[model samples]
Target chain A: MTPQTDRRLQPRRFLLLTLFLAGALLFGLVAGHEWASPARLARAFANSGGHDMTSQLLVVWRLPRVLAAAMVGALLGVGGAIFQGVFRNPLAEPYLLGASGGAAIGATIALLVPLGLPGGPVLAALSFLGAWGATWLVLGAAGLQGRPDTAGLLLAGVAVAAMLGAVRSFLMLALSDDTVNLQVVLSWTLGGVQTPDAGGLAILALLTAGALAVSLPLARGLDLLGLGDDQAFAFGLDPARFERRAVLVGAAVVAAAVAFGGLVAFVGLIAPHIGRWLIGPRHRALLPASALIGAALVAVCDGVARAALPPAEIPLGLVTALIGGPFFLILLMRRLRA
Target chain B: MIAVDCASVSVGRKGTSLLRDISFRLNGAGFVGVLGPNGAGKSTLLRVLAGLRAPDAGEARWNGLATPRWPARKRAAFCGYLPQQFAPAWDYEAGDIIALGAGRASAGDASPGHVLARFGLTALARRRWSMLSGGERARVMLAATLATSPALVLADEPGASLDVRHKLDLLRRLRSASTSSLVVAVMHDLDLALRFCDRILLLEEGALVADCSPDDLLAGDALDRVFGLRLQKVRRHDDHDWVIGLG
Candidate 1:
């Protein structure tokens, strides 16, 4: 809001973010089970049917994985921004608020219990339910409807997530003993980008687009919500009704992101904060910035995870946690100091 | 055009009431000051009348329609509320906050620049809210409150943090605004309310104790008893009165 920040910050922000994302994309395309040159990667990306082994490897596996990472990251980032904006709480994110846990539970159910539905819709629907349920439980427990309490919400989120984690574990165990396979549990727990499938990647992309389409219009109303509930009502928005719609959108986005790649932690948390700190705090700028920055963040993390060890690979969630935990701590310290 | 009929607001069903069967009606533009001590349900009344809160018992009516039943957007277009406490969770420039009043939601035509200039605050538009002084921030918010040029302006303690000069300036502006719009404000300053307000609603213990002209309030026993202080008119001038309170 300073005069120093006016007119100069926005374009520069997009420029820097674009450069950052390009670098991450190149790094993502290049570093994998086998190293491909950036040029070869680009060629493979442009021409999907590359006959050579390295080109095929880049085209088939690496490209979809990287794009999926970017898509999931964008969803999480925008989801986090929406929650933070509507709730007016800096710490509001899917992972911290237990929405991810809810989605995990729903996804595990879809994997274990055969509803005869296809993998995509079942996963999306149940995960959406889980996410929305967990978010509402947190809000109700934290008493967010009546007052602003960061500490209360944080505690409530922790408690609900812990409870949901227990449920997820029990379901996973029962499924492992009965008929369901164990690999899905491992991937969901480790939270990594699996070998990419083109159709799944396409679905992730579409869902990301749909969530963003719904969220963009909610910006001005969310801005009015930053004013107190009574004041928001005076300004023609019912705070409770508007919050339900926004929370539903945010939960849906987070559920879709998690369904793609288990539970990628802190892309949501880190991307939105960076956008808010570096750029202005308006939702219009922050939402897109958060998505782009989040895409870049996850792409870089996946690149680092694969490239860090030669034959042995680190989990994407662990790397993100290693980076995001410290970042969250620093943010917490700053907020406490303020 | 604005009225509350036997309206009541309470905490829980069969719980302690915040407002106890308050009833009044206003037909035209006037500056009505709601004067009370702390926790006298002054803000609660303002919220009900502004259509922000529906009463548990009766109704807050605008042009005869019940507020809670009215479509929310329509009510917003009619009533403008200025809260006693405005906590902005984000960092925004003064102009940005003012612009919120006119765009996207309400079909208000009075632009932010015009409202800012009306308060003689065109300079503070671009400044960070953190950089502005308390008085300057309050004025900016006041401009935002009036940006829509709402028919009924319900302000809760609009000048609670202002100095003498700023308080007088704010009151004068509100007085002028009242020529076209009904302006109701919760006031703590008895002298200013007496000098500037056309009518006064005296509230005490979750009840409307008196509804009368400001001069009648100054001459009445309710003012002395409700506020738990001796309030007197020391000297009278044509334009204003020299009133003081001794507690």
Candidate 2:
């Protein structure tokens, strides 16, 4: 192909991808405003201009939460795409490597300890450490006997996740009667878009950007990788190195998202598959498309959870699982036939 | 010119050796067919030579630079590899699959149109890979591998699912390719190997037992030991010997 035509198509393709993502983002913003009128949203923004008590409440209390939702949802979607592509398994997700379970354990620990520290930062830091730590453990275990094996890593992840979940359950049982504190823990566990502090949002945004920067450049390599490790190596890729980098980047992104947004499921598993179904497996396109779709899906789900019962907000995680569970079954059935 | 040199190479985990100490060099352009029994490590050797798997004891040098030294994308640009199966993760169109061969080059390099037409896959260019027959998919994969115009092509079991006509046609194409490119293929069909391969490497128990030109390798004793078959080479009107094996 001539460079001229490639250059031409590059902008056209970029525009289309941008348009798709922009459309999704716009839809998310619009849907977010469903419960609050434009006047109310405007007033909320306006009242925050003075840095007074009302401003602090509006800015710190409201805007941060909504922005956190968007940022976390976007990160999970993109992270999911990367994991699925790197593993060459349509079923792979951020939580498949035990990141979520580890994070849950960390959060459970924070909750159990009466540390008097603000829960958000402590939870975020613990979750990040837990997720990355679990990933390292899985990698270390896989590397113990021989070189890393995809199946081995997956099996290790499942085992570790189950173990962590059992421990978390035991901890939860121990704290079963602390109603006030338990409610707080339950809300976080059930996963909601609690407004993060400005500091947390900034950190998450930076981490997400870094992960995307590191991963998007590997789009072509990811395409070749989908053919299988042997084929990928034959095509001049160092599969082991690529796998390590992918795991690191994926783990980091998922950690950041979970730390900020709690245990939002389905976006990671479903977004990439749906994106692949729509745009094919070109990672360059799949990454951005999945991010948009994932963000939109979560945003819409959050909207429904907030308003579905009117006055009683449903857990965002429950809503996602309810939707994702059936969707997963349908995909599995389709894959079986194929 | 592409030259592959494997010196005292071995591959495996712990003590179970897949490909024992093996060494060979193929420099000039010609088709080299690798013939081996099921456990003889033919595919492992192919993978090693293609830079897919590293040898535990030795190394593979491509034009003296060492396989691991060259940048992956650069190496891929010059060496095309086709595996036994080409199943993609998604239902990529035949055209898209071909385009992957072009690598970092613009999508135009593998004008999906031109390649599909060349491989008689024009009608199926828009079809999902999963929708194609084994034979059709094989042809499309072959087309994709060749789209890069690499100097060396390593194909593992390229003719496994092909029909007789396609088998013959593909062999003919490989033969033509040898005029300008070095082609190494792992073949299961003894007759096809003898008919199309300029040289044949007969492997037994993960070791090179025979390395000779097709005419010489098909001799009675060598064929009997390597393939465990009694064979007769009859001269055809076309000046090529027809190898007939009797079990």
Candidate 3:
């Protein structure tokens, strides 16, 4: 008989994760070009409303940026975990599965076309459509019969991402003469927290909240799916319906994240894997844990992106990719070796 | 009670029939063995009967309502389905995987814990999917299937990959399940089927060639005709006999 996985150390791990998230949030709040001293932040926190310049900067600039980063990170993280579960592949994530690719294309189209008639930002709306459309296309193409074959789905995701990348590149080149527009689009393509306006942030928050609410309850269904379609069916869940619902929620969350920043490459992939390592693979604990870790990872990355070169910020996506690309390689090597 | 009323299933570009107008009704708890040659559509019939697939024509019903009409959870609560080959790819703990079968905390006395204990798998709960031996995985799958206390247990070749000891162990579990739940298994072992099954369903080319007790089936020479082999019964004991197949 195989020995049980050790459970005694999980509480300590959870504690460390929580502390890391808090520390990351603090770093995002204080570590900018004009560093807000820990004493100043504490005084501001105690005062709530003050006539100080530091307090106003905290309210007007820092708070929204930090909040936006956390929400977007959580969205990608949770989206990644769900995609991994639905696809039954460790490498599956929102960016790799065509959700963010679709979102990026949609956001770019909105930028180029200038659809002014909208209750919400045209960019956000189009990105949502793009996200849902691309993810669904992958699923439908992989297999519309019931559950998708993992290899086929992964290949389809890669194909969709590649085709969409070509379209995005053409659109970006079209704006080469418009250097300002090109710069903005370029930042987004590389994936980073652009830190939206209040309205944009509100929409992102709403989308993130709604997607997470739906995903947590379906954890058990995801667990069943790891076995395969036939076995999940025998266990009572309509595996097809489960896959569709997972796509619907996952796509929406990914779109909201990508709409703000661009591709935001590795948060989804990195967060869920780390979450699984920290907590076991049961989606119940794993999903929430992934969301927390994702929020922390992006917040810290965004902080570093801003603080790295005081006057000039590094692209957040570039930073994540630097970390994520190697992480992906290690995982691949391990899988091959095994 | 479970009944398949003129259920037909066809597939492929040529519309080849997999199960052809098969009909049968089985009531209460008893072991029913489905026997067939290669390409006889035993697996197809099992899928149709399990309501995992909708038949091209007619219906498979539990009680009076068509099983397809039942919500997936209700179907899961009522039926246990075991495929010929099923092994989870993820590294979920064996206990967590088995708990996936329980629609409620306890289905009569058939909770995940109870089923695991019954299979002497209480110590194996912590084992991950990768860590399990084939025999252990087989037993774990069986435990998960039975955890819901299903009214109907449908097994497709449950004994396909085990050694003699594990095969007998699996057979005994199925036999016990049949005491309270109807067990329908796609079986290849003629000797085991004759010894354990109360009834046998012999299919030839997607047709129900024989539906009878072991004696009636043997006396009628249906096995001889279907398998294209001579069946000779040799005396072993007063209550048991050894059946041999020869050209």
Two-way TM-score contest, 1 vs 2, winner = 1
Instruction: Write down the C-alpha DockQ for each prediction.
Output: 0.70, 0.43, 0.67
Tell me the lDDT of candidate 2: 0.73
Those runs of model 1 whose alpha carbons end farther than 4 Å from true positions after fitting are A1-9, A42-49, A178-180, B1-14, B104-108, B117-120, B236-239
Per-residue accuracy of model 3 over B1-247 as CA lDDT, tens digit each: 5543334444222577777777887878989999988888888888887887777776787876788788877778788998898756568878877778764333567666777787788898888877898788888888888887788899998878988788878988999999999999998888888888999999988888898998888788889988889989887776766689998
DockQ-based CAPRI category assigned to the predicted complex of candidate 1: medium
DockQ of 2: 0.43
TM-score of 3: 0.91
Ranked by lDDT, the better of candidates 2 and 3 is 3
Candidate 2 lDDT over B87-195, as tens digits, reads 6766677777776765533446556667777778778777777678777777777787777677788889776877888777777877787777788899998878888
Q: What is the per-residue lDDT of model 2 for residues A1-338, given as tens digits with 9 covering 90 to 100?
A: 11121323545655664575555444433343235555554565675544565545445554555556767778888888987776676766667667776776777777776679997678767776777677666666655222234456668867877787787778888966766667666676677777666676788678767767877987877887776666666556777788777776777677777766777877898888767766667788788767767776776677667657766778888888899878866765775576
TM-score of each: 0.94, 0.84, 0.91
**DockQ of candidate 3 relative to the true structure:** 0.67
Cα lDDT of candidate 3 equals 0.81
lDDT of 1 at B141: 76
Expressed as tens digits, the lDDT of each residue in B20-44 for candidate 1 is: 8778877788899998888788888
Q: Candidate 1 — what's its lDDT?
A: 0.80
